[model samples]
Target: YDSCVNSVSDPSIFVIFEKHQVYPEYLIQYTTSSKPSVTPSILLALGSLFSSRQ
Candidate 1:
């Protein structure tokens, strides 16, 4: 998913995901507790990045 990662402008986050999920099952717990959807968080991240650069 090169396009997806590039779209984020933050491939390292995915890299961490790929490398660091020491316990795969914990991902389930983490996701369950996280925002219902990633869209809002991703939008917030993009907004912050753009705002900071300006």
Candidate 2:
């Protein structure tokens, strides 16, 4: 898992997950400026991450 946090023009968080053959790679991005709520985006990404493990 590689993560990057940038706070330039638009503050945002980016995550990259490198998986094996059994799982697919996931790129999770969260922007702080555009959206009014960030929980849904985080929850959605986490849901996908956990579900893929099963």
In candidate 1, the residue pairs with backbone N, CA or C atoms under 3 Å apart (3 or more residues apart, or in different chains) clash, namely none
Task: Compare the candidates by lDDT and give the number of the best one.
Answer: 2
Per-prediction TM-score to the true structure, in the order listed: 0.29, 0.29
Tens digits of per-residue lDDT for model 2 on 1-54? 354447647767644454442354687888668646668889999999999995
Candidate 1 Cα errors over 4 Å, as ranges: 1-38
Global lDDT for candidate 2?
0.66
Number of backbone collisions per candidate: 0, 0
Q: Quote the positional error of residue 40 for candidate 2 in Å.
A: 0.3
